[model samples]
Target chain A: MPILIKDRSMVTPREAIAEGDFSIGSNVYRREKKVVSQVIGLVTIKDNFVSVVPLKGKYLPRVGDLVIGKVTDVSLSTWIVDIASPYPGVMRTSTSLARRFDPIKDKTRKIFDVGEVIVAKVFSFDRTRDPMLTVRSDNRGGGNSPYLGKLVGGRVIDVSPSKIPRLIGRRGSMISTIKHYTNCKMIVGQNGRVWFKGNNFEDELLVLRAIQKIDREAHTTGLTDRIKNFLEEAKKNMPTPSKEKQSDKEKRSEKKS
Target chain B: MAKNKEETVLITKDGIRHDGRKREDLREISFDVGVLDRADGSCLIQWGRNKILAAVYGPRELHPKHMQMPGQAYIRCEYRMATFSVPDRKSPAPKRREKEISKLLGEALNPALFTYLYPRSVIDVFIEVLQADGGTRCAAITAASLALADAGIPMRDLVTGVAAGNLSDKIVLDLDDVEDKEGLGDLPIAYLPNLEKVVLLQSDGIFTPDQYKEALDMLVPACKKIYQLQRKAITDKYSQINEAVQKDIEAEEKDKPAKDKKKAEDSKAKDDKKAKKADDGKKSKASDKEEKKKKGLKKSSKKKDDKKQASKEKEAKKD
Candidate 1:
């Protein structure tokens, strides 16, 4: 079935899971069997309840998952940050950040602000409302000090947390295509948020559309070419001064007859 | 199939491809059905970006006897992403994605084809993606349907695959390699245009129920659009074959004049005797040919009639 698209909203495999509708692609299957934690997805109905039947290969982060995260806040004893899930996650102080035990003298403030993002790992979790998180997986600075920085000016996209694999396409075929084409650097958060940075705005915007295309049709084949074509169209649609250098006459001719 | 991180999918600095393609549009789509004469049905669909070939074997046998039911037929789908299809290459075996797709495709096609009539038999669909981009599974499903139709399987419906996804929570149709990886909410779908039923769906980022449904609604029309193309493709294939066959028959009969002389020599004697016995047949044909010739017509109705009659007679004889 073609997806049940809502008004311009990008729905995730996870939302379908939360709806009590088990998912295979975007299609929802009513809960039947005892789909366990490995059931990578679920249907969330009533917002409080969910039925998730994970895949066998799916794994829950035990003490550590070697994940990356961003800092959301810096409290007295602990810090709060988004960990790519509905679950609120926290990291304790005294791990780093304030090497001199002086929050005010912390030189790390130069790098991070209230909305700064970072790459860190899941230190531990209690599986409750708030799981303990840490950036000090390698025992560097555990708090939101060092790796915390701005994810500069590229378009950001969100995806179903569940479809990260597809967006990445197998071993990163999808992301690789975007990077190679747009000459951009992208970071895909486990939380389904993507950050892109390109040398310029044109390539960056193209990267955005290209990633949007992949996110839309991750299940499609020839995704690279399809995306390539889409961008070609988008580029053409956008009036530009460098017409000669931008045209895909050869590729168009190949597509023609 | 695994994606390659280094590869650029779309949009270079000057709007050129990483390899180069125009900013807008599609890769070339080349397809041929029944490429393999032996398979019940087959097709090779090459969408500029990827190459895939599909073959349909049978509604013929239902093996492992136990798997067969008494009143209904079974459709078996085996989806495999070829080892070399992706950048890093994949395992030859059917993995979770492939298995899930096969099942979904089987369901999507169930309503369209008349599978129930062929009880105790299994219709086997095998899909192979030689190269994959973003939507390999959707491609596989779309190709499988065409292959099945090419194989001459009786089905109630024809299925078309289409997809749309969300990036930064904005919905877009047909995600590309890069968008799929970097975008939010990848929703890959397969459906029948006529029936308006969704057979398969998968998504990435979060979507509100309303937004998801809207995406689906938008996709139905697109599915139909593609279905029309598929229909045209199928029709065009058959028509080309029909035209070729007709031309071949004409060519085969090109030597008729020489053959006729030999036949005339052999049956000339008998025909002369018969003509003498029935003089009216010759007289009427000559008059018909002459009337048209006098009217300044280069072609004669008599010859046209003769050709039709000759073909009909040949057909009868062959039968």
Candidate 2:
């Protein structure tokens, strides 16, 4: 009765009615009542259920969800992808695997090449930890099989996979604020995977610093303002392109139209 | 009413009674009527700390009038307390105390009512005490009176009750249970403020004739104030009648269009029925005349379907 909208990277519950042109992850029914899940995308119709194929990878994590994964050999095709839990993600191609890819692809390099991390879903069993995971639908880039994005590293902290939306804020505005100022290539993994790449090595450290600040002050007000100040101070090393060029580009487009 | 062997005064030179009441002050009494919708009539009364809700049902067709006296209607009164009404919870049902109070209360008010106006009719009064600090019986009487009036039963006058008890030996107006048990004397009286008569009277302990006169005299003003409240309750109930009548009027307005639509359909159907009857007559006469002409020509389309059926049967037998 609930479907994750790939575009917004948010879940739309069954009670909400969509306005127009939305995609349904599956044929949903409860006591003969149909529920509309997503607004638009390629939905894999398997059996009676379906899941949307996201045009972009935008997986927002919930507080406690289960994910599955595989171990790639030592970060070549070698990184192991984790489906659930906070630590031991894609085991840096160094840890153990629940399973492996096809043999034609070399165990170490073919299946998951250097920097290749796949998607996985969580299936937590114990009360204290997350479900250790496996792949979901193939249409989801074959579920969390590492598709494309940076294996962003930082001093990782755990958050309720649930609180991710509130953290993202309205229209990704909060995260966007962090991105605009930090200038960090931030990739949020579908299965609670969040990675950050700085313009420079210093920029990466600065991004980690800001992320650490957010983790400490997530429950406060005026977070965007605080993040802006933090980024403005960090931007001394790497500033942005001049606004004059952006304005001129806008004017040229207006004239062309 | 008689005073006990020991007597003391409630107020001192400071000019305040033991319960902080002024010398001539009446106890606080508040009432609301028609609080329940399903009941024919209902009221809630708060006389100081005691609280009661009374529901009245009746003047309807009586199932059995055998209990009625000759030339008079029967009256039923039930006074019960909720399990949580007192400091300690009570049994689920109204027990011995409730039974006695119901009987005593029914008798206390019976003389004032003119139940003989309608024969084979029963008036049921059910009173429930929610919080019984004291004077619950008196509260039940006042609430029942309002409920009866709310039911639109014709009454001589509204009965207003005020219990004047000796608290610390100074005759106080309405005592809480503690004071009632501890006081030297107690007098519970219900009177008709308009008729100027005591419809109910009960006295505990002994008091001088002068003291009795003083207690009764105190009730005069106290009961008058209570009468005003009961009148307001009845008026409020009548104001709600305005809305009930308005709802019926709206229903009638809605019903008019439905009735008109049905009538229009009936008239239109009458015309259609006449047309159909004429068409049937013409068709019957036309068919009789055309039968001879049709018999002259034979149709051949049915022959192919019938021949196919016969060939298929022959093929099946050969197989």
TM-score of chain A of 1: 0.57
Each model's DockQ score: 0.01, 0.00
TM-score: which candidate is best?
A: 1
Reference-based TM-score, model 1: 0.43
True contacts kept of 2: 0.00
Task: Give the alpha carbon lDDT tens digit for every residue of B256-295 in model 1.
Answer: 5665575466455455545576554544443443333334
Top candidate (lDDT): 1
Q: Which tens-of-lDDT digit does each residue in A179-224 have in candidate 1?
A: 7666688887655677888866777888877765555454434556
lDDT of 2 by residue, B173-252 (tens): 77777667777788988887755888778888767787788888887898888777776665555445545645644664
**Per-prediction TM-score:** 0.43, 0.40
Which 10 successive residues of model 2 chain A have the least lDDT summed? A8-17
Q: What is the lDDT of residue A211 in candidate 2?
A: 63
Q: Candidate 2: lDDT of A60? A: 26
